[model samples]
Structures are given as structure tokens and as C-alpha cells.
Target: MSRLMRISIPTIRVVPQITPGPPPPTVAEAVERVVAFLAPGNVAVLTGAGVSTDSGIRAYRGVEGRYLNPNFKPMFYNDLIEDSPRGHSFRQRYWARSFIGYPRILATRPNPTHAALATLMRTSHVSQLITQNVDGLHHDALRTKDPELHSRILELHGTLHKVHCRAHHTVLRDEYQMQLALLNPYWAELEESFRRTGNKPRTNPDGDVELEGVSFDDFEVPACPECQREGKVEMVMKPEVVFFGETISQQVKDRSYEVIEQADRLLIIGTTLATYSAFRLAKHALELSRPVLLLNLGPTRADGLPQLEKMVVSSGPVLQEAARQLASSRLSEDANLREVLEGGIVTSIEDV
Candidate 1:
């Protein structure tokens, strides 16, 4: 049995880790610790935008869990629901910026961290790979390497690859982008020019770039096709991701909790646990007396919590090294099993 499994569960709720623990581990120490923690397998991996930063998606927060771009306001769920000029303008701005930025997100490939996670999943080390990112890069990476393990990934925030109307009419984001291009030919040309010149705008993690000195007042946003067919005046379509102030779907929340409950331990990567949704999972692990390992740089919301180990290091390299060690161990296990089978000592079978 693992050391983590022997820990006693707290009858009281686990609070956030506010006080500091020991000094941060060195890179070597961090790797060793990560390997030992994950070697027991059945680990639940909870990642955030930080994991996708290497693939060119900017994380919303800095190391300390503060917004990286203080001036930038995320599109709110309330803004999308308001039936006023402000809402219309907000919709226009969002779609216009998304039209320009979505292509870059599509163009980016998953990074080393994604590949390492996939390797871990393939080796049966991870019980659940839950990510707060909406970029769908994890899905992309898994499809390429560990296609069978795709079901193990739980996207806490909905994916950017899909768009939906207020009535829940959904469409493929690529098709919607083409529709946007058809509606706004001039902006499409501008986007093409920007791409050609290698002058892409910096985008937020939600796949929208900041635009200044550019007016989106005239930019067109297509209504949902089903809504249009049903004679609805304007059912604005938006990316399927959970907007700021929006609650995650109950189904997703239930699944996330289920995965956390079933795992032996929780491993957090690339996130500071700024959001309660992600932080709660770690708290749940601690509450269950299951160990929580955070492999992220800077301070997390749960930084000082007992039963949680924080390693201040880049997650990519640490994950890569851990995957390597785990893979090697798996090969050794397979060889041992093969040798046991070759010995022909299991000729007799007992029915239970």
C-alpha cells in the first residue's frame, strides 16, 4: 500500500493551505518526489491554462494567481444574456476577436507536457486527466497518441472547438469560423494578411485577441442556424466554454467529483488553483486523506495545506522525467510478468 493511502481522513473539512510548508524542492528533488507520488498510479491529474501556455495560449493568471492582464476584462455570462445594445456590442467584439484568434489556437500543436501526460495515461498511471483549459489541446494530443484513453479526460470548462446558441444549438467551431468569414469578408482579409505577415495578435486563453484602435461595431455575428430556422430574431452563438461568472454544468461537476473520489491521489499541474472549481478538487483529495501533489511554479491557493506537496518548477520537464521513469518501470514489470509466465508454474488454476 502507498504511504498516501495510510493517511487518516480529516473529519472536518480541509481548509485552504494559507501557511507555508517546507522550502521548495530542487528540480532533481521535485522530479524524484513526483515519480514517487505518481508511481502508486490511479492519480487524478487536474491541469489549467498553464499547461497550454507552451502551445502559445496565454494563461489568465500569473504565478501568484493574479490576472496577468489586469486591464483585460473577460466576457461575462451576464453580458451575453443581456438584451440590450451593450450585449450586442459585446457579442460583436467577442466574435470579431475570436475570428482573428481562433486560427492560431487551431494551428498550435500540443506541447511536451501534453505528450508526457498522454504517455502516463497510456501506461495506466492516471485514473482521470481533468483539465480546466477550454483549448481542446488535450483532446488533440490524446487523439494523436493515446486515442483509447480519450474518455479518461474530463474537460472541466467546455471546449473552444464547439459553439452553441442560447437554446443549446451547437455547431463545430471551424464551420462557424467559415460562416464568420463569409459574413465579414474585409475582416477575413485583414486576418489573412496578419497571418501571412506573421504579425499575429496576442490572444487570451479563451481564444480571443485584444484589439485596440479597431472598431467591431460593424462586425457581424451569426445567429444559430437552428434558431434562424425556427424564426428566432437573434440567438447569438458563442464558444461553448464556460464564461467568467458562468457555472459549470452539473453533469461535468458530478463527473469531476466522481473522478476525484475514485483516484488514489490528486496531482495538480500548471495551475495556481485560483478558481474554486479546481481548488475544491484538491481540497476533496485532502479531505479524503488522499495526498495532493501540486507541480506548479509560484503560489497556489492551497499553498500551505497539509497533505498537499507543492513543487515550484516548470511542469513540462518534471512530467517528462516522471513519464520516462514510469515507462521504464512498466517495461520492467512486463518483463517480469513474461518471465513468470515462461516459468510454467501457473499450470493449475483454482476456481473461486
Candidate 2:
């Protein structure tokens, strides 16, 4: 449990300027500030669903600050573990929708924000990148673009690419989805048809699609293979993600705090910080007196904190510009250092 309390501070809201002027900073100025903020490096980034929204994933809350799907409620942790028909039904609905949505999730490519972050991570500008999304886009971005620096990212919410049993037995989500396709061939074919027609279902931030006109009760749920080998009868596999009412693992919490402690500043991007886990990180950074910057599209839970600076702007463009400027600056610095080294070498040889 985080014991940190929020410190009140005056809010400085800077909406991106279309015309570069004085009343509000231009987008270029905002980019410069972001670059300067990252100049010292050791920036710990805490991202949310907003980061992946550009990749075609929809956030829970929209720009109007309301739930996009008012009728949709996420499956709770307790409900998933309950040994009842409801639990079975929940699993059926979850897997059925996930079966249809998995392809889209798999097909999603990282957007500009991810690309910018990858550059920063590769250059050591980011100390740690913690994401609240289970989409695994950050992992994808880093793995493909900056493979060696992939370890810098910590998926705060467990990823959708994994499934786990109550016994903690884990398996790749792709393998489990394959099992689902085999068991529910009808839905599998339907998903393919949907893809062919270019009418895919709306996907939630968690990677489950909003499916309709289907009987989930008839959907077959796959059991944990490890548990089944042990003679377990009931199917009890769940996505390896933090559900609505679940507590995050202690290991992840500790690791997040460790990075925040080492970071000189905290830059929260693409999230409203609606969840406590994400909110506490900002609070933790403030507790440590580390400067915090929110580069989000809208109001966050930590809006009025004294140590925090809120920049309400589109994350993609600002981040891209910042990364470009930082990379250029780094290259210039390296060139200058090399020049100095060469000059020193020539001087030493002449003296010899």
C-alpha cells in the first residue's frame, strides 16, 4: 500500500497552440520543454491506454471524460475465481470475445509515441518504462526496434499475450487461442469472415472485443493443460492481466518503485491515471520530490499537484519532435567529444 498523500499545487494548463505565440505555448515550445525535461535523462514513464489508442485500441474513457461503452463492465477478479456457473459463463464470454479480438491485437503496430519512446530508451534517456496497458505494444516496439533495451519496459498490468491457471501455471496466449479456435470452430470461422468483410468488432483496451448476437454459453473454454495433467476437472484459465478488482503483484510494485526512486523525473503519458496503481506512481514521484510531468490528452487524477506540470496535447507529435531533437543533440555532443579526443591525440604525438 502506498502511504503517500497528494500535495496540492497550482495548475498550469498548456493547450497546444496552432499559432506560435505568448498566451499559450506553441506545439513546438511544448516539444522543446519535453526535450529539455528529458535532457538530464533518467525519466521514468508511466503510460496508460492512451498510448495504444493510436494503434487502434480504444480507451475506456474518451475525450469527453466518460466511458465509451457505458454498458460494459469488466470481469472482476473474484468473479473469475468463483467456482460457480457464473465463473464458467464469465470465462466463456471472455474467451469468445478474446478469440475474435486476438487477431486485431496481434495485428496492431506501435504508433509514433511508441517509436519516440523506443528512441529514448535506446539512447538511455528513459530509466524505465512502465505501462498500464496489457496490449504488449510497448514490448513489441522495444523488442523490434531496440532489442537490447527491451528489458527497460515493465508491463505494470500483466500482458494479454499470456494466460494463467489458478495454480499459477502459465502458457502463451497464442497457444491457448489456438486451443480456443479448435474448440470453437464456428466462432473462429466467424472471426475470419468478419476480418474479410472489414467489419471487425470494437476492441476494448484490455484487448477483448465487444461481441454481440452470440451465445457465449455454447462457447467452449479451454482448461489449463498443466492442471488437466494433474487430474483437474474444471476449466480455470484466465488472461494474465490484472482484472478490475485485483491487486497487482508485489514484485511489479517493488520494481516500479525502484525505478521511480532512481529516476530524476517522472513523465506520465497517454493516461488519465484513473486506476490507483498508476495514480500512486505519480504520487510516489512527488513524495520523492522528483519533478513530474503529465503529457496526456486530458485531465488526470493527479491534476493539481504542486510538483506536477500538465501538458494537454496530442502525445504522438510532441513525443516524436522531442525524440528527434534529443537524438540530434546527442549526435552533435558525440561528434564534439570525438573531435576533442582526436585533437588531444595529435597534440600528444607531436610532444612525443
Q: Write the per-residue lDDT of candidate 2 for residues 234-276, one digit (tens) a residue.
A: 4788888888777777788888888899899999998877777
Q: How accurate is candidate 2 locally (lDDT)?
A: 0.76
For each candidate in turn, the TM-score is: 0.85, 0.86
RMSD of each: 11.3, 10.9
Weakest 10 consecutive residues of candidate 2 by summed lDDT: 343-352
- lDDT per residue, candidate 1, 187-266, as tens digits? 99989998888776777788888788999988988888878889886556778888777778777888888898999999
Q: Assess candidate 1 and give its lDDT.
A: 0.77
Question: Which pairs clash inside model 1?
Answer: 17-305
- The C-alpha stretches of model 1 lying farther than 4 A from their native spots are 1-23, 144-148, 230-234, 329-352
